[model samples]
Target chain A: MRSSFVSFTLNGEEKELLIAPGQRLVDVLREQCGAMGTRNGCGQGGCGACTVHVDAVPMLSCLVLAELAEGCDILTIEGAARDRTLHALQEAFVAEAATQCGFCTAGMIMAAKALLDRDPAPQREAVVEALSGNVCRCTGYEPIIAAVLAAAAMLARLPAAAA
Target chain B: MTRLRGRGISAVNYPTGMNLGGDPSQALIHATTTGNFVVTLSSVDLGQGLRTIMTQIAAEVLGVPPESVIIDTADTDTGPHCMGTFASRATHRIGNAIIMAATEARNALLDVAGEELEVAAADLETDGDGRIAVKGVPGKSISVLDAALAAHFKYGRTISGRGIYLKPRSYPDFETGAMDPDSCQAHACTIAEVEVDTETGEVRVLKLTSAYEIGRALNPMMVEQQIVGGSWMGMSHALYETTEPYYPDRAHGPVDFAEYLMPGPADIPQYDAVILERPSASGPFGAKGIGEMTANSPIPAIANAIFDACGVRIDELPITPEKLLRALDAAAVAPRR
Candidate 1:
C-alpha cells in the first residue's frame, strides 16, 4: 500500500497528515484528524453530509481524495465559528430550530454558507436550490431555508467577520 | 390543456400507544444540591425533542423554570426502564410517569419547605420562580437552592420521586370484537391540491393544508416539525418511494439513498398545519404522542387527489407516472358510461 503525506490549511490551522491511496477527504478528516462534525451519511457522493469548503467552495469531501486536498484551504463545521462565538448562520439555525436529528446540519450549514458568502440576499428559491444537494430527513427544509435567509439578512446588517 | 388540477381530502385517527395496550414507561427524578431537577429515564429522544419536552414536563410538575430541570435519558446505565421509543408512546407514556414522579418530588419539597417556613405542606405553593412560599405570604419564602441545601445538611431528607405508567392489556370479547386498542387517539385531516401533467404523466403537489388534534401542544414547535417533516415523507410515499417498485423483481430496486427517491427541498410544497390542543385525560399535562402520525393522512389524500384530477383510481403505493398513464390509457380504451 502506498501512503503519502498531504498538507492543507484546515479551519485556519495548517495540518500535514499521512494519507493512504483512495482515502477520502472525509475519512481523513474524521478518522485521522478527528473532525467528527463532518458526518458521512453515505460513502458515495449522493448525500451532501460530507460537504466541506475547499478554497471557499462547497465540495463533497466523500468523493474528493484526501491527497487531492493538498495545499488547499479546507473548512468544516468545526471552523464555522470563531473566538468561541457562533457564526450568524449557526446562531440563526438555533433561533429557528432548523435542525432535527442534526445529521445533515454540518453539510446543510456549509452549503448555506457557500450560498450566503456570494449572494448575501438570496430568494427563497435560491436558498431552496442551494440546499437541494443536502438531504435532511427530519426538518422538511422549511426552517433551514428560513435560517439561511435570516442569516443572510443578519450578515447584511453586520460588519465583515463580526459573526 | 396538458395540465389538470385536482383536490382531495383525507381524515384519519391515530392511536397514542400500542394496540392492545400492555406497554409501560418509567421515570425517576431527584433534585441536585443546586436545586436543579434531574429526570432519570431510559427513554430515547431520537431528535423528536423528547428531552426538551420531558424537561418542560418535569419543570411544570416541580413548579420550577424549564432551565432548572435536566433530562438524563441518555442510556440504560443510570436510568429506569422504558419500553423503547416506539408507537408514539414516549410523550404520552413516559410523560405520565414524569408527572407522577415530579408530583411526588414536589410533595416532598413542600414538606421540607413547610418545615422551614413553619407552615403546613399544603399551605406552601411553589411560585414558578424556584421559590417555595406560604400562600399569601410574600416575604416568607425560601429559595429552591437554600431548601435543597437544607435538605442535604439540616433536614436530612431527599426531594425525589418515582413514576410509572402501565396500560393494562385489554381483552376483546369474541362476540363483538371490541376492545380498548390504545390509550388515546389523535385525529388529522389533510387536503392536498395537485397538478397532473396529462401528456407526460407527471404529478406535482401544490399544497397540503391540514388540521390536527393531538391532545396538547407541550412543545408546539416540535409538534410542527413532526407534522411538516412527516408530510414530506407521506408525499414521498405516495408518488416516489418504493423498495419493490418492480414488484418481486427486485433488480431495479433503489441501491442507495439517492436512488431511494425522497422529495428534495425543490419538491416541497406550501405545507400548512393547524393544530388543536384537545387535552386527553390520561396524558401528561394533556400531551399525547404525535411523532409520525402526521404522515398518515397525506398518503391517501394525494391518491384521492390524483383520482379527482384524471378520474383514474390508481390503487398502488408509489403511484408512479407509468401507473397513472397506464390507468389513464386503460380508462380511455374501455367503454365509457
Candidate 2:
C-alpha cells in the first residue's frame, strides 16, 4: 500500500500527517492525532461510535479514508469541548446521567450536537431522529433525549448570559 | 409518594429482604456492615445505570449525597475481586454491599461525631448533603467530611469503608435450570403496533408502549430512557437487524449497515414508556434490574401486535415483510369452508 501525506484541521488545530492508503480516518484521528474519544465499536461503520464532523457534516470516520480527509476541517469529541469546559451536550449528558459505559458517549454527544447546532429548537421527535444513528446500550434513549433537549435549552439561554 | 406508571403491581418477589445479614443488629437500627464499604464488584456497566443506582444505595445508607459517594469499578489490582459487569448484578448484589459498607462507615462517623458534638448518635442526623446536625441544635453540628476527618485522626486510620458480597450459596440449581440465574429478575410488557407494507414486505414499527416491572426506580427518568432505548434495539433485532456471515461460503447475511437494515431515523416509532417501580424486597431501594429485561419483550410484543392487527402469528424474529407476505399467501391458500 502506498503512503500519502494528508493535511487537515483537527480540533481547530491545523496539522499534516503521513498515512497509508488503507489507513482509515478513524485510525488517523486516534493514532496520529491522539484522540481516543473517537471509539471504534464496530469497524464496518455499523455503529456510530466513530462518527465525526467533516466540513460541518457528521460523517462516519471509519468509512472515510485518511486521504479523503485531506484539507477538511474535522471536528471530534475532543473538539466538542473547549479548554476544560465541556460542551452543553456533554454537560447535559453528565447531569442527566446519560452516559453509562461511556463508550458511545462521544459519538452520541457529537451527533446530538450536530443536530442542535443546525437547529437549536428541535422537537422531541426530531431529537430522537437525529440520535437514531448513535446506539447507546445503556441509559436507553430517554436520558440521551432529555440531555439533548436540556442542552438545547441551555444553549438557547447562552445569549441571555452574554447579554 | 410518586406513583409508578403502567402495570404497578409488585409481582416479582425475593424470598429474603435486601439485607442479607453480615452481623447482628443493634437496637433495631439497620446493622452497619464493616470492612465492606468499598466493595469490589464483578458486574460490568454495559451502559446500564448500575453506577447511579449503586451510588444511590450508598448515599441512602451513609446519609450522604449520591454525588459524594465514589464507586470504583472492579479492577484486578486495586479493587477487590468481583464478578465482571454482566447479567445485571451490579445494582442488586454490589449495590447491597455498598449500602452495607456505607452504613457501617456512617455508624463509625456518627460514633465519633456523637463524642465531638456531645450528642447521642440517634439525636444526630445526616442531611442529604451529608451535613450532620443535632436534632434541635441548629448551630452545633458537623458534616460527614468533618466526622470522617475526626475519625481518621482519632482512630489513626482512614474513615473510608469497603465491602465484598458473594452470591448466595443456596441460589437456584444450575443443573436443572430451575433456579433464577439472576440475583433479581425484571418483568416487562411491551405493546408494539407496526404497519407492514404488503407490496414491498417492509414492516415499520408505528408505536411502541413499554411497561417494565423494575423492582424500584432509583431514577424514574433513567429507567424510562433504558426501556425506550432497549425497545428500539429489540425492534431492530426482530425485524431489520441481522449480522452477516464472516466467511463468503457461509452465505452472506446482513453484513454491513446497509444490508443489516437496522431501524434508522425513518424506522423508529413513537415510544410511550411506562416504568413500573415495584420495589423488590431484595433490591437496593427495591430496584430490580431493567437493563436486559426491556430488550426481551419487544420482539415478542411486536410479533404479537402484528398478529393482533393482521390476524397472523409469526413466531420467528425479524418478521420481515417477505415472511409476512409468505405467511399471508400460505394462509390465503389454506382450505376454507
Q: lDDT for each of the candidates? A: 0.90, 0.70
Model 2 agreement with the true structure over B175-254: per-residue lDDT tens digits: 78464334566776777776656556566777778777777888886777677777788887778654632356646565
lDDT of 1 by residue, B172-290 (tens): 98999988879999999999999999888888999998899999999888888899888888898898886656646677678777778788999887899899999999988887788
Q: Show the lowest summed lDDT stretch of 10 residues, model 2 chain B.
A: B23-32
For model 2, the superposed segments whose C-alpha errors exceed 4 Å read A1-7, A16-22, A67-71, A83-85, A91-100, A112-163, B1-40, B76-78, B118-122, B158-167, B171-185, B243-249, B255-259, B335-337
Best of the candidates, DockQ:
1
DockQ (Cα-based) for each candidate: 0.74, 0.44
Best by TM-score: 1
Question: Which docking band does candidate 1 fall into?
Answer: medium
lDDT of model 2 at position B252: 54
Give the distance in Å from residue A142's predicted Cα in candidate 1 to where it truly belongs. Answer: 2.0
Model 2 Cα lDDT, one tens digit per residue, A12-32:
999999989888999989998
User: What interface RMSD does each of the candidate structures achieve?
Assistant: 1.0, 3.6
